[model samples]
Target: MNDSGAVLPWLVIRQDDNGNRYRVGRYATRAEAQKMADSLDARGHKQLYWVERIGQSVQ
Candidate 1:
């Protein structure tokens, strides 16, 4: 959970050349989510990968 008490608050996102975005996965920590995004980016695919934090935690 993040400091905001959100579970799996980090999200790995993938965006293709067509500008379509997809949610790759969610993680408890930003590092974990960034790892997944970096790993995917290393593949050298046309798609772009990145991470973002969830703005609100579900109660």
Candidate 2:
């Protein structure tokens, strides 16, 4: 959460070759989440990574 007391909206998700999906992390902004996904992708692995907005925030 940021100063606004709201849950972070951005998420970094990873999908492995086995099709298992995992939540890497959450960020306050999409850019931050995308950057993390890109950095992980640069590692040259079979796993796939991307960013998305949270469908629903934590109460």
Candidate 3:
């Protein structure tokens, strides 16, 4: 649990395309996304939206 006693990740994701999509995960920090992007398993680009969590955690 975090300081607020909520099970939430450190950062979220957002796709930087025409759609401007978004996603959330239980990551420990924003750097984790960087690491995931650096070592991505996909063939395309690692474009993702990142944001700090607020309020209650989402699934």
Best by TM-score: 2
lDDT of each: 0.85, 0.87, 0.55
Ranking by lDDT: 2, 1, 3
lDDT of 1 by residue, 10-32 (tens): 88888889988888998989999
Query: TM-score for each prediction?
Result: 0.80, 0.81, 0.37
- Give the alpha carbon lDDT tens digit for every residue of 1-59 in model 2: 76779778899988888888899998989989999999999999989898888895322
Candidate 3: C-alpha RMSD after superposition: 6.2
* Count of backbone collisions in candidate 1: 0
lDDT of 3 by residue, 1-59 (tens): 86778655555555665756566455665577555544542446656444555454434
Residue 32 displacement (Å), model 1: 0.2
User: Which candidate wins on lDDT?
Assistant: 2
Candidate 1's TM-score? 0.80
2 versus 3: better TM-score goes to: 2
**Which residue pairs overlap in candidate 3's backbone?**
13-49, 14-49
TM-score ranking of the models: 2, 1, 3
